[model samples]
Target: MPQKFVLRAAAIAAASALILAGAAGSASAHVTVSSPDAKPGGYAKLVFRVPTESDNASTTKLVVSLPKDHPFAHVGAQVKDGWKVVKTTEKLPQAVKVGDVTLSEAITTVTWTAAAGGVPPNDFDEFALSVGKLPEGVDSLNFPAVQTYSDGEVVKWEELAKDGADKPEHPAPTLKLVTAVTPVAASTEVDNPDTLARVLGGAGLLLGLIGLGLGLRAGRTRKATP
Candidate 1:
């Protein structure tokens, strides 16, 4: 009975370890955005970090799908050495502004293709770009990306939620942005002015009343006893 109990305990421990390992793998597979919050009417430098699989194959290409309805959809990317960059443009219904400039069309997609053996196993790369003149009313920006492996397998990261939920199966690149608001100024005038004035005024009034009462009592005592 003792030996049987020990064997059953070992089997349970092994199953627990396998479950934990699978959870860790799923957590590590999501592609993440590194920079540039999507803000309206702002200029930002955006970066997407790509991690290749740790086992055998390296990442060969990264394709980022830009949002069609973004105010600054006409996007351009900074070129990287030894990597081929491609940009595809699309039309927009409205124009966005950055400072004093107005922008109409924007780039819809950007792709970065690595040279042969550029990204190796257990390594990573960053795709960066200079973008500006984002429109004013977006809370978050989502980029669904396609990551290609050397063996022709593709991983899609493109799940977004309105309620900000995380998708365990496929995750997309995201950026949270905040708009600038006016700040309140500190007041220097009336921290304790009313309290100080009331205390002093009440003390003076009480002393005057006490003096009058004492004078009347003294007169009455003199008149009755002398």
Candidate 2:
């Protein structure tokens, strides 16, 4: 191959690799809700995906906080291997009516703890739950989560997304409330674009600019020499 052609090919290859790496990193960033088929004022089964982030420890515990104002009338968790699921309930100061009944209490938090083993570094686990009568009053539900590592490190996933601002570093997992439409799959992973993706994309763009500058400089030098 010609030297110039080889150099150009190498630059293109490097850019492609950068783009893919950025994509995968963004995909595995944090805990997310997947396979959400819930509609406003309806029941749906959703899966929570948690990725182990500690390099020195395994993820041993997770606590997902439900919305207190728009609580789920019914929420059930699926059994997991080597893990215990616990629901903590709190009494409401004022009763809220639902489906011809008045209720004064609700499940505020769902916790999962590993019995023997846990999700190791670079690994992930998914927890499944069914919730009904999703609050129709809000546009979405925010489920802040607390993750505990085997080394006692606690990471809070409670940041909220601000209007017209970048996504919070540790934004809480959210489930948007939308009008009832065609039913979706049992669960789906979040495909939303994240900050890492944008940054990696910018890296790719920079590489293109560098190549353009090289080409223009080469053309000027050849003309001056002739």
Candidate 3:
């Protein structure tokens, strides 16, 4: 009987660990950035994936901060149903230049408020942004976000993890700008990378056509001169 009890206890402990591992990697995991086209000096579709970790409270609001060190010239939010998104702008302490364009103000924070039903406990949602002229200086951008729950609980996702295994308790969502880097996979309520790929492909095609036209024009000019 003693041996049987020990075996049963060990099996239960293993099962619990599996459940936690699954949660940590899935629907109840950290808030993350899903960027398919995050190359430097290009426009990108950035999606913020928010998961409600609370067991009893519903997530009602989210506030994401855009760092000033790495700034974007333009920022816009994707419209999501059942949620109201507000982009808040603040005057920069110092004027920053972006590709010959000077700006005095910038969007510093984005907030999403639940309109109807907030994200229930253990459920997740996604918020998106369309930002242009991503800075070419940095290889990555960090976004610090806050999650508010209906039960008067606030969780801040702002830790900057050094590595995957050494991740802090609440690691902030980060987007890697290098095009070659493979992003970590996530499950549920994230933007589709295929849609972003199509948009970028169309842009590439347009540029190619423009280049071809310019080349042909130059050739014609040379022949006419001779």
Candidate 4:
């Protein structure tokens, strides 16, 4: 009987562990930026992966706005089928030089509209861009994006993450820029504190489950030893 009790408790612990891990993954399963480690005064490929969040409507459009203060001197987007890409450039307040070339205007916004079919439910799409000369002395860059649904609903992802505060409901996608040597440090700096807490909490829960299982086994053994 004690052995059976131990096995059942082990099964429950495994199930609980799976649930905790799934929740941790789900927390980060939103719009995200996947790119190479960018350095100051360097170029990197910026790719945004967007998942369709609405169940009733398909994703029809995506609009990404770049930061004005730290503008990229050169920005270009990759071509994707079934999507019409549009880039809008605007003159900067002051001209900036890049590799002996003076740039008065820079790409500010990139929008992608569905050419024929939209991203259906449970689907995702990636948009790529080449950006050069990331602003120096900045830890990260936030690209505020807007997702448009076929049903005319607009979802904005522009909230910034603040320390010691709850994560925003619609957090904007951010790309971390690191220097040549301190790449690991940059990653550590970007780790969300809440995420660390969640991981530790999950570990604690698993340990507690194991302890409970052991206690149950002991109790069953005591009862059987009449």
Candidate 5:
């Protein structure tokens, strides 16, 4: 091959590799929520997990904004050691149910600040809150997040809302409320009609093709020789 052609092919391969690497890096930067469950008119512990670009620099601080429309939106958070918790309340149009009681409104924002010279790089921290009395007539919750980086970079993990949806731009984490269903019974393994027919059909076609190829080769060899 010509030297120029070889160099061009190498450059194309390098470009393709770089493109793939960039795509993978972007996918890894998403923030996720862990350990979430809420029962209607009940309290639960919600934990938010924030993964940084550089785990080396510990996550300095995290701020979670509660949804105003939620029943327990203004509920207070349980205090944690080694961190300072700040709560901001907001007024609501109607009352929200907490257990047997109804609350007029709930806290709007909850921020957790680390101690001075806080968590170092390359480490993770957990922010836990005791949430009380989830609202009624809701199945799922979506918690939006705002993450702060050591290098003065802030990332917002808020998604856009859809039509006729109760979702917010940067909503708080959510939980699913499901009723338990009992299983009826388990079935023994039996050959599936469609799958079995397909498997047999494929095997027969493969064998037929192999046989035809062998017969043609044998006939050609005979004609080529004596």
Candidate 6:
């Protein structure tokens, strides 16, 4: 093999490694909102995915702030083991009619403190909330969150996306409210792109090895003949 080819291959490998590392980092950088049954003027179960980026610390608590402007008629956290849920409510500035009766107050904040082993390092957990009658005429809703690590580090995922600019490093979890859409998988992990990428990468590598083996066998046979 030529020295130039070897150097080029080394450089290419380094570049590919960097690219994959960046992709993997971005995939689990911040919290995300996912829901398969989210639609306007309907009850939807929103699941917030929280991935612990820390290497040695676990996530101890999560605080999610709900929008006060367009208050949902109801908001309730689904029961999850190993977590203590706390919800706070306050009087609304102005009364709004939901169906027949007017609402006086709404849940403003929801905090979940880990009771057991919290989220382990390099792992993720999902918190589900059942909120009803999502406001219409809105494309999406933003849920700002505060993540607390066991190492006394706090990360605020609350930056809204700016137009015509690069994405924020810690973007708030945003859920799109659609009027119509096809059915999707119940589990958000099934739709994870990272898993798809890993599967494809493995398959491609296997095929490449097989092709290299066939080429070497052919070259050896040709040299052994004449």
On lDDT, the candidate that comes out on top is 6
Residues 135-191 of candidate 3: C-alpha lDDT, one tens digit per residue: 887878999999999988899999887755766888899998776745565332234
Root-mean-square deviation of Cα positions for candidate 3 versus the true structure, in angstroms: 18.4
* Candidate 4 residue lDDT tens string, 1-226: 6999999999999999999998776655677787875777788899999888766888899999988778887898989999999999999898877655677888889999998778887678899999887777788899999999899989899999999999898889998887656466557733768878888899999999999999999999999997
lDDT of 2 by residue, 100-193 (tens): 5576998889999999779998788998889877766778888999999999999999999999999888989998777765445423333335
CA deviation > 4 Å runs, candidate 3: 1-20, 23-28, 163-165, 181-226
Q: Write the per-residue lDDT of candidate 5 for residues 1-226, one digit (tens) a residue.
A: 9999999999999999999998785545455554455566677777776555674555666788776667463355657677788887777788866666677867767887766644566445667777766666776666677777667777777775677997454444554665446444323222657767888999999999999999999999999996
**What is the lDDT for 218 in model 6?**
97
Better of 1 and 6 by lDDT: 6
Off by over 4 Å in 1: 1-27, 36-39, 93-104, 162-166, 180-226
Clashes of each: 7, 2, 0, 0, 14, 0
- lDDT per model vs. reference: 0.76, 0.85, 0.86, 0.86, 0.68, 0.89
Please list the residue runs of candidate 6 whose C-alpha ends up more than 4 Å from where it truly belongs after superposition: 1-23, 26-28, 181-226
- 2 or 3: which has the higher TM-score? 2
Off-target runs (Cα >4 Å) in candidate 4 are 4-8, 20-28, 180-226
Give the better candidate number (1 or 3) by TM-score. 3
Worst 10 residues of 1 by lDDT: 182-191
